[model samples]
Target: MTGGTSDARDRLIEGTRQLLWDRGYVGTSPTAIWKAAGVGQGSMYHHFDGKPDLVLAAEERAASEMQDQVRRILSGEGPAYDRIAAYLLKERDALRGCPIGRLAADPEIAGDATLREPVRETFVVLHECLVAAIEEGKAGGEFRDDLDAAGISYALSAVIQGGYTLARAEGSVVPFDRAVQGALELLRLATHEGR
Candidate 1:
């Protein structure tokens, strides 16, 4: 592809990412994407088969970015508990909600397998990362061996997603902060040295 064509495609993908995160699949129209990307309709069609095809590219990009961020935090130097705490405590735009997690509630996206696959896989990978961290902590005696890593991973994931929902619902970040704090406190209790 020519430099201009490549640039247009990248713009479209990025525009789709922003629109999808803010407006969802149904609400994000082709015209909106074109407008956001500053590309003409012909350019959009020339670069993509259709909105779904372009959206797949956008979702793939978003999922990859999210995975990279999580992997970096989880794999960083520290005790497993510390790494997990960092993952949970990391700053976020709580009111805006999780880019991928918000897609879970979008009827148009959730109903379509092609568009939903990346979102599903993103969460699956995140859960696996969390499970690994918990297992590592258990092995190192930072957490109890009797704890269910998979279950705790699921709980942590839920807390984060639910925190976003709660924050958005209330139009404030307090609920989200409270949810994260609660989760962190529970983790501290589970991994307490005396325990």
Candidate 2:
């Protein structure tokens, strides 16, 4: 009984995650979550107060996963340049776009202050971490001293989102790959020349 209950809850959470990814928050519903999880309405309501509650859970799941991935990539042993470059080159499915960025576009998500606050915080935290990493690289001479960590962090993020948008619009991964490659090459040049 205990295992069954846990499985059902996990299924609900995982289902919500995928559903939110596939569809924006405005498009996801408690009914959809129940159907996807193969659980009943009562079961979902038992786990969450409502859709907003469940959506928050899904967002947190997505945020935590992203944070874990970023930490792992940045933590790799080597020069900061290599680590940052490796992080840029990390493979992605290319088209679905970032989970966190997807959340940012959900109208329902933005309207809910409770939900919106954390979602905004997630990006802020991610940007801050990237900035810190870049700053560390600058100090270590792996990046240019003139590099603005804050500006570059946002630029990097914008490039990623723009790349994904371009790929989805064009229905090709070439644009996405080119964007990252171009960004990396520019970074390499800038850092090498002590930008």
Candidate 3:
């Protein structure tokens, strides 16, 4: 309600976002969130009903941000293939993995509908955006006419998510880079024009 109250709420949400990305729902405690946000426990409880409530808000913010990034890259100028390439090749914290994708592996998130919805919706939107781009490329003769846009889109997304997993497992970004490069190579081969 007041300016200070609003600022505390924003800090709490942001703290939740970072904690969720790093520690996951189960590992992230209310105290940790409050500490990260530099707010008192009362401030946290005043802004949210509980941990799940706060996490839902954080997940929503993460999903919205991810969607905005994907939309901007996929909808940008250049050929459809170029746009898709840009989306795939964008710089990322390969070792840390995707914020939303990482949530998919969390047991807490998997069991809770309120926490999982935003994560699920984020991927749904990502797949839809990729499919649209691939379809556009196919229509423009940039990609193979016989190619399946949905299938390709799914594969591309899988590569990115899996790349993060593999990279983290190896404790290096090389695996992530290779996975992305491999995916891009496959796309180039699939497209009529070689890039």
Please tell me which predicted candidate would have the highest lDDT against the true structure.
1
**Predicted candidate 1 versus true structure: per-residue lDDT over 1-195, tens digit per residue:** 899999999999999999999999988999999999999999999999999999999999999999999999987788988899899989899999999998888999899998999999999989999999999899988999888999999999999999999999999999999999999888888884735
Candidate 3 Cα RMSD (Å)? 1.1
Stretch of 10 with least lDDT, candidate 2: 186-195
Record all residue pairs in model 3 with backbone atoms less than 3 Å apart, i.e. clashing: none
Q: On TM-score, who's better, 1 or 2?
A: 1
lDDT of 2 by residue, 83-190 (tens): 777778888877888778877878888888888776787777778667777888888888877888888888888888889889999999989999999888877776
Q: Estimate each model's TM-score.
A: 0.98, 0.93, 0.98
Error of 1 at 143 (Å): 0.3
User: What lDDT, from 0 to 1, does candidate 3 have?
Assistant: 0.92
Cα RMSD (angstroms) for every candidate in the order listed = 0.9, 1.7, 1.1
Q: Candidate 1 vs. truth: CA RMSD? A: 0.9
TM-score for predicted model 2 compared with the true structure: 0.93
Model 1 TM-score relative to the real fold: 0.98
Clashing pairs in 1: none
